[model samples]
Target: MAMMKLEHVGIMVSELERSMAFYTDVLGMELVGTLDHNTPGIRLAFLSYPGQTAQLELIEGYADRLPDEGQVHHVAITVDDIEAEVARLRAKGVRFLDEAITTLRNGARYIFFAGPDGERLELFQPPRG
Candidate 1:
């Protein structure tokens, strides 16, 4: 049997430099590397959480883009405290899609937000028994 763990979540961005600033400076993810897909005009950047197994990939290109209306589909990260995380991000001038806390089917708390490219990003923390 083949076992696999999630390598990274890819987000498509219109402006690479702006998105890089948000993810690196604000979100605090370390820039891992950058690559070109060789499709005439396409570039991709990889970022990783400091001292963690998760990674985020930002892809910039001219192609079919994200949906017209509604929040961009998101990649979520679990934090130790949902409320505290939200507050911290809010203090950093990050705006959230929803301020109210929500409970998932499995009983976890989460909130969603938009990144620089309007890509949805979720911050969640699982409930303790």
Candidate 2:
């Protein structure tokens, strides 16, 4: 047997709106679609970029149910407005992991944050110089 190609990454979020803001606004990913789907014991919203097949499945309805160890680390999302996005999200009450910002010698800047479900996520500003 052979494992098929990767399909998508599933992230169980405690709050949908918080995930939406970080993925859509902060990361600048299009909210291709969302739904209140149901199967047997779970439901979630499927999100992805336009013309992209792989998706980001934001699983919800898991209130305070922490995943097993090594559930997830963090996904790097490229952003052009690192400063502005950080400010906006901060105003929205999104606490960041690091107390300050960090910029690399390659002209790239980045920061980390904890998602609504305690999912560690990162935003990176590509090298512009």
Candidate 3:
């Protein structure tokens, strides 16, 4: 078993530039990086504050359904061992959304699961050595 820490909050947006500006300019958070995120229908922008707080993920969906639907997408929690954590959660009868773990350009590996209320939850790990 390993410690889990709150990582980032993902939000789907209509406009990437506007959302990025609002987060960086208005919110005063620094832009960590942007990526295609290894998945379709999303343009990922990761931002963070000055200290050890959770980062903000701006996800701009390809489809124009942001106004109708919602912005908040998912919550990510970082783990020391993603495989071990996933196995542990699975033993408790947790349902995984992804067939396999997803690794991004930054080397972070993660898997999505559903919370009690159907909210998307992520278990993340740093780039593997």
Best by TM-score: 3
Distance (Å) between predicted and true CA of 67, model 1?
Answer: 3.4
**Backbone clashes, candidate 1:** 0
- Candidate 1: worst-modelled 10 consecutive residues by lDDT: 1-10
Better of 2 and 3 by TM-score: 3
What are the lDDT scores of the predictions, listed in order? 0.71, 0.67, 0.86
Candidate 2: RMSD over Cα atoms?
Answer: 15.2
Give the TM-score of each candidate. 0.50, 0.45, 0.88
lDDT, candidate 2, 48-110, per-residue tens: 777885667676674457566423435656667788878878899998998876775446576
Worst 10 residues of 2 by lDDT: 1-10
Candidate 1 to native Cα RMSD, angstroms: 13.0
**Clashing pairs in model 3?**
none
CA lDDT, candidate 2, residue 94: 95
In terms of TM-score, how similar is model 1 to the real structure? 0.50
lDDT for model 1 comes to: 0.71
Q: Kindly report which residue stretches of model 1 are placed more than 4 angstroms away from their true locations once superposed.
A: 62-65, 68-129
Question: Which order, best to worst by lDDT?
Answer: 3, 1, 2
What value of lDDT does candidate 2 attain over all alpha carbons? 0.67
- Candidate 2's C-alpha runs over 4 A off are 1-72
